[model samples]
Target: MTQKNKMKKYGSLFMATALLTGALAGCNTDEDTSSSGGSGNSASGDVIKIGANLELSGGVASYGSSIGDGAKLAIEEINAAGGIDGKQLELITVDNKSENSEATTAAIRLAEKEQVVAMLAPATSGNALATVEIANKYKVPIVTGSGTAPNVTVNDNGSVNEFAFRTCFIDPFQGTVAANFATKDLGAKNVAIYADNASDYAKGLAASFKETVLANGGTVVAEEAYVAKDVDFKSTLTNIKGKNPDFVFIPGYYEEVGLIVKQARDLGIDVPLMGADGWDSPTLIDLAGAKALNNTYITNHYSSEDPDASIQKFVEAFKGKYKEAPNAFHALGYDSIYFIVDAIKRVDGDITGEAIQKQLAATKDLSLITGTFTVDEFHNPVKSATVLEFVDGKQQFNSKVNP
Candidate 1:
């Protein structure tokens, strides 16, 4: 769906319907490459080509590697099921190393060099945003399993980036959910926000969480900033400790978040700690330790502990295949493949970027492991967010927050 065509289909809503970019899930780059078989658009042959621009290595590698593994699993399942409408799907992967520039380069390579009709975008917001123009220029729809920032789909001018789509909810949504869980569920009358100043993802979540805190008749006792790679947080946690807040919200990815959680516990500032999905990583436990992570919480896409039949089934399959439990990024990665294939199957005739783009935009109630959602005009999935509590160094499903 080109911007012009989208305007005709949805009208001026898409114009003011746009959003500005102020988000980053943050990607780190890795130097590696992989391919299944054959390249180029499936429209040219019987095998559909899919491009994966992922953060297979580098910082936040857990996010990229998990997503890649999930996408690979989905591709395997589809191919084993006799493929998409009898045409096999080929995943051509390029490691973005979790960097924004690398993400853009990967997109270009996949779209122009590989000639894939659609591409899977980098998992983080900043990296995903870097590829928007490329996706638009090439008219190839790029679906992200975990790009949860407004800017990924909408441009700064509030214009919709028609070719970009995400399976995860935006950062603001998860942030709001966190605030609600803290204030209402945990009975926190005062919440302190410790945001990663270097991350647009953290910044966006911080702003929304503050707004919700005030709206809920709660107080923002303290607010502090930290960069992405800072190892020490005792100074900041000490300041927060003085404030005597009932809860602490740290909006950051796992690497830093793990350190903060551990240091906070060491400082004896043991009020409940909460964050967005950025905290979803096994490394978090290794960093924070099981005892330190006891009261930590996060808003995530899916819980490995969910009792839903479909979710449990997926959990078992993922475990059986990977020999480890699948994280949210993995589930998102897996779901993204189905999302793209679902649209491809719905294309009227030959599968092309434009056709797949339109179908993706029109997707309604598409069921997947993360959440069932209808793609909104913003090119985001309208779905539920799960709040998980870290108990004994593992994420346990706590509750679900609906939009």
Candidate 2:
């Protein structure tokens, strides 16, 4: 049973921990979140309900909006091709407002009030982690398109959250790839790290990246920090510039990173800058002018410039629909909808959360717009990552790193 597409765990609930990262071996199947529906089977008559708790209106709005756009496109195509078992898929999206508390509230609404069979987690790791317990409690499979934090699937105590899954690789993989790119691809002997102090996302990437950088005999000449929502990076850039490092890695969201890049360039700090997927956003180019964004690179899920026929097809279709080229987040979002439907197709019995969760756990070698991947024991997707270079504020497909 294949054709339509190809592509791409949990521990306890750690309220505050490292963001963007792993898993436990145990699986739990407890049911309690739904009172009217059994095993969170909101899908009954002619529609399958899937909830999307996304950051649609705040700081990280771009990520959620792009994901929503991609998911909508997939739903349209799947419905046109005859949706799962003659039932149309319905996505109930709740705007998390890019806040953790809002995300949790949205998850509660989706799981308890809305009673969706399965739900899409938030785009950011911290926000996604906030919704894990809701999924586990309700026995609803919560799939995240780009939550790369390992703890999203596994707890700090080494327990796997059975209902949680992610399509993107964890932060360690992303960091290691970026470090290898900086040292091996860019020939850097020394590197500097500037991270978001307020975000575990930035901190997690910085930790993994530093370890790999030191492993490669590269020196961290300077380390700096900034909180989220920072508009001024000149002071930090001044310090970073004085270090005179060959490469600078800023593991933060697009908002701060954009200002950092523009200010860094203004200060004549012309070294190559790098980051993880958090840098993928349209607002980044507007914040940091195209010229300032040049010589920057990011370890991303997919690039619109990739020449693969499948990828190009998705890009063209996305451009036609949204009037803009798709980014890594968009591709991941598109892949996620198909991922859930793929699992639903294999369910012979009730389309309950338990049934869908079981099918999702056994997914193997499924290909999607991002890449082909299988769900690992920890519930994270083991897939290749792409390195995209920014030239004139546009992402160019650099190379792919296979695990």
Candidate 3:
């Protein structure tokens, strides 16, 4: 072979090698590279996967359904307005069945199998608590909107769970609000407590309410406990009625609380009923009956009747979308998703579990559909609670308690 031909062949080979190397480097660039977990390209080339581990069916189905609906509204609006960094957001939902063990399994599926960047934890504090283990194990952040139990994000030793956060105020504040409203507004000097012993949320709120009732110089005449899914609260109601308390505070899910209220009223023991956000379900009115729901109040996250522009806009949007006013659970679910989207936007790239978690920790006074609040050091939102009264089977906005 000629010397010129040999040089040409070697040069051509070198150029080919350089071209291949450049192509490989290009693929590793920011636009082409994908992160691990469901947030990355494996889930969808141009969509961000967010896990919605919710109790879509079972005792708390009403709460879960409302929450999911609100989340759906927020997701649609966000996608319509150009999703985070131009990538559409996708929700990968799993039903926890309103059970703690199932919640843990759902979290595992979301974190390990689906590889979601973050999860909107179950609507209940009990379920959220169960899912926390998976969040920490997988290094993914999980935020709950309606989990009001203080320990939902705060550990028993007063430390914040790094991967856990919630949008709602803690039970201490909510319970205190209820106590004050009962004693100050209702002129109640004696109160009875009925709690869902099976639920961490109910137990936490009940304990806080008792503490506050004493602090406010009101006597807790009696206290009773009931398990979830227990339809019969007649005996408990009879015991509470016998106490002759001026009002009864039942911190439990709407499902059981509805029956409890109906039974309490049926026994001719009609005082006043107060509860936490758990009672903000439409089914509660249906189950308890409009007459039973009268003279009742609950500490809620948001009231659809709020005159605030943001609140009104959200309410209108939700009503337009679902053809029903958004409840506290719906607002909570909507706000939780925006929080996640905000964190993802702040990160700008590589939507991974670690990245989203870090950004979520740094969140500031983020305005949301529920309320405006900053995430405190303990990962609990520093927000206000709204006191709502049931009038003619509808929840009316009574007042707002700011932090």
In order, candidate lDDTs are: 0.88, 0.89, 0.86
What TM-score against the true fold does each predicted structure earn? Answer: 0.89, 0.90, 0.87
> Which runs of model 1 end up more than 4 angstroms from their true locations?
1-42
The 10 consecutive residues of candidate 3 with the worst lDDT sum are: 32-41
lDDT of 1: 0.88
Q: What's model 1's TM-score?
A: 0.89
lDDT of 3 at 280: 82
**Candidate 1 vs candidate 2, TM-score winner:** 2
All candidates in order of lDDT, best leading: 2, 1, 3
Worst 10 residues of 1 by lDDT: 25-34
Winner on TM-score between 1 and 3 is 1
Q: Rank order by TM-score, top first?
A: 2, 1, 3
**Candidate 2 Cα outliers beyond 4 Å, as residue runs:** 1-38
What clash pairs does model 3 have? 38-115
